[model samples]
Target chain A: MKQIEIGHGSGGRLTRDLIKNIFLKYINSEELDPLEDAAILNLRHQRTAFTTDSYVIRPLFFPGGDIGKLSVCGTVNDLVVSGAVPRYVSLGFIIEEGFSLESLEQIAKSIGEAAKDAGIRIVTGDTKVVEKNKCDGMYINTSGIGEVMRAMPLSNISDGDAIIITGTVGDHGTSIALAREEFSIEAGVQSDCAALHDLLTPLFETDGIKWMRDPTRGGLATVLVELSESLGYGVHLYEDRVPVREDVRFISDMLGYDPLYLANEGKAIVITSGESANKVLEILKRHPLGNNAALIGKVSSKCKGVRLKTRIGGERLLDMLEEDMLPRIC
Target chain B: MIKTQDIINHIRSLVPGDRKVRIMNVCGSHEHTIAFSGMRSLMPEHIELIPGPGCPVCVCPESDIIHAITLSRRADVILVTYGDMLRVPSKDGSIRAQGRNYKMITSPSEAIRIATANPEKKIVFFSIGFETTTAPTAAILETGVPDNLYILSSHRLTPTIMEVLVKDAEIGIDGFIAPGHVSAIVGSNAWNVFSEIYGIPTVVAGFAADNLMLGIAEILGQLKNGKIRTGNVYAGVVRPEGNIQAQNIMAKFFEVADVNWRGIGYIPESGLELRDEYSARDARKVFGLKEIKEEKIPGCICGKVILGKAYPTDCKLFKRACTPKSPAGPCMVSMEGSCNIWYKTN
Candidate 1:
């Protein structure tokens, strides 16, 4: 019998397979399209974006944010990237029997503060305490609902569309990795986990916005690869143009992790027409969360898969992440 | 401050337009730079950059992996190794396939820490790598490991494999881009025989695009002048004599022995074994481990792929039966392996 491995939850090829072979196989609904971050449903003549995400990050308290904050931001960003104005979230906690009550309270406080900051409300909540070792300290599941303010369909994406990123990539993944204290090397890198609703709200007003995705789990490369495969178009990314922090670059290089494949929390990959590219970039840069925003790539019909233009002016194809990022043996 | 463009242009100007020059890199990082940067696409069609036996994990003997898996299954033992080694498949299945009792570590020191933490458990550190990683493993041993900590060394010498590649007539390697990090320990002097005896142009290169391009240009320059010599373009880190202290430490701990490489038969003096003096801390000795006959997964050309005899695409199973998600061969398991890099970038 095939058993589940850790890679299945790594948001790579295995995760895609698990969703396809199991989740999508049984849970058949037109609204349950796995390609989009959130489900778009029409309820009482109103289009609503519904998304749910679970947080099971180890060392729940990391450099920049804790599990509470991450739980709120992750789900909110999903709706935001789906062209929705996130308004309500239902938080569910699966706490281990021996989890510290003080830590639980602290997490609850963080969730409230984060929800307030994102302009969303925790309208409903549920809690369950499991036996020790049944859960890893605690796991938070948040299902978010938001009004679909705009419909940015993938059909609008075409050849020559611009791919813009809101900020630097890999901060969250790097910070979390360091927080685990696996490698002794220390650097002052923090997670970039934050809600993207405020920062991305302005882009909704702009014209030619094709689609947007929060490059969270599998990072920017996976998002683009999925986009290319789904649209049957090509994504040409200028690798050097993709914004990466100096510390992120150093840590990733030292650890044999690619910054392009590392997870980013407060980032959105926006696909827009070439004519509106400059405007989208300008709007992103104006937000504090998007100070490092950049026009990284463009869509093209010349190729079928995602291709990267390296700094040395060479081109290479990029595939969706297949496994968890492991440190290379020299 | 050499621009990549200038180096490319220089290489273009130096190469004889009609000649076929096959340069092989015996380091995973070098192949990674070449594949990741799409350097092959930038090069002339006549110039083929082949990835050689650079991935230590890919070439790691199946017997050692099987032994490690068996040791990991023991109730009193804990198997620890580099993360890259977990997914490599043998007839018995990968260490990861067993799922429990094995811990992935990034450095050798973590083995000591784990050993120290769990005094009751027999901590078997399944150490595997080339000289770059071996130096650190040797250093950790010199520092004195805990009583419970044992080492299962699958360390292979890089220069020895490179020698095997050159001796293989079918591969036809015209030049070599020697591994940068390995040379930092083994030194550029270690690769002298390639240039001096074999008359193959060799250049030690760092993993940067411009630096690699400079190395390529130097090789082309030597080919054009018929003056084959080993050159060091990564002088910023790799020294001619290397870290003498590291070499001395390695010499103190390990003795060269004939080791079996997966897909390839035993190569003389190609592997490092723990000395008799350290037998007490050798997992193979402590656990009375026996080597099982190595079995190759059918239709997997990982052996040919590692020796640069064939490309990943040449394998009928490539991307069809073997992939990173479900690697049928060792080459497809590690990110540093040529097949894995090819799969990711191609």
Candidate 2:
């Protein structure tokens, strides 16, 4: 209790406590992003969205991208899914003592390159240094500000609304976990860490979009559970429809982890009117990041929590994840 | 697809409508498959699939946890266990929440690695699981262990608890979906007692959608035809005689002992302990820890829940006092536990 355990940063129960007891107590949740990814603020006559996220992954550089690129992509993706056109993003860094200057430059270059790819600018940034062992080799935080192109409120979501996800699931979590080489499991899975602005932009044009979320910390089930719980609706997801890579699924099975519960850095959950699902999916598949997109489930008035209709046609509650073993792996 | 539907229809036809038929699955993995696959919804309304004490973590006695915790409190001991045992709460606290030097592992083999890496510190593998896991732990022992490596075996026999369940009249389990993994060790012949002696039906099924349905269907087939026999639908893995080598390895290092079950009181010869030859590597003997006093969690129905006599929702503390995040007893603590599986899945 003296110092925080690894679970406090797990983005599950311990993370909730840190937020509810510390962050939410001092800062109202309303001021933050209702989705908890980024904040939505009305500036002048137009609605603007803002979001901030920190990247503290081990190794700092992974297969798909480095922490710097991830920091930028994560913040911008939050803004994008909130139906915002990401415009400007700020960067912040906390480096440990005796860290390599060359590595710092490499991370900085990765950050700049990622921002360029997402068509966002580095408007402002901050830097700090801590003693060795006090911090990891490096930690990064990125905040993005964007203009709301349209509104896709959870309030508009109703029974019969369909839930759609972009591309395969569990790549980011699986990639990072495998990179650790803990269980002697080897897989050629790459992290699906990229900006979603291009993939989600087309859907923003459609008025059928009820609400959108990026399933990051707790995967698709968490976002669905949170949205359903908030809106007092039940979700029925088809297990077969959820697209997860075979290798990822294999590793997940070997480790007793659910791919639905694993983190996905490059996936989006789109809730739209039932009739518009095919149209939205068609638009999404036309993009690079969303080629494997699918209409996975629908909002139901059946029950309060989420349920998964497994491949065998049996139904079970897909409850929100509890405390998993590791956290920063995300 | 046609085969599954035919099985489903046959199962539905065999199920008598007047009274409820409660068929219990005593394997944690089986319960997970049933819930995750939505197998329950496919069954007829009168057919109820109850989870038994198949989950090893759910039935691990609190005294073992107390013993592990006391050892974890030591400065030189590093207690290693599978993740399921971490969150179970006892009188003082759980091994994860309260222990000073405890680490979560995927298997017992990691204990060897931990022991090798830290030669100066003593490594005590707090082993807890059913036969599927126990066989592996025993195999690791046959290969030999490091000097500092010790095992705090909390493994329990699944058949013994199933016997306990049948003895309790409160839980009228009509049949059993015998744990396939356990059957792989003990064989389909091991569960013949339930069918031959107790006059109940037992089916050894794998942890798959089709396999489980076929198992349930086979049980219903027996009940409808008034037949009592031990069937093996998971023939690919389980035989009439189980994996003799793994069973032999288990017998080499351990023996059955009367042990206390969490919530459920002492069940005679229900647990496995290290034999006298392996006493040097037994942490319980090395630690000299004595008199493990068991404490009851007030208002907890975990004992009856694992016995299949009550549902998780029937517990007063369920969702209120006990949850997967903060479990008060072993039932709500393990993912395989009847309560945790029901609490999360249902």
- Top candidate on TM-score is 2
Candidate 1 lDDT, B1-346, residue by residue in tens: 6677888989888888887999999888899989988899899777889999999999898999988888898899899999989999888888999746999998999999999999999999999999988899999999999999999999999999999899999999999999999999989999999999999999999998788989998999999999988899999899999999999999999999998999998999999999999999888788888878887689999999999999999998888999998999999988899888999888
Task: Go through the candidates in order and give each one's C-alpha lDDT.
Answer: 0.86, 0.83
Error of 1 at B7 (Å): 0.9
Least well predicted 10-residue stretch by lDDT in candidate 2 chain B = B1-10
lDDT of 2 by residue, B38-150 (tens): 78899999999998888888778788888888889999999999987878888878887789898888877889999999999999999988888899999999998899999
Top candidate on lDDT is 1
What are the clash counts of all predictions, listed in order? Answer: 0, 3
Scored against the native two-chain complex, candidate 1 gets a DockQ of: 0.60
Candidate 2 residue spans exceeding 4 A from truth: A1-46, A324-326, B1-3, B75-78, B101-109, B112-123, B146-150, B277-282, B285-287
TM-score of each: 0.86, 0.88
> Model 2 chain A, poorest ten-residue lDDT window?
A24-33
Q: RMSD per prediction, one decimal?
A: 8.8, 8.0
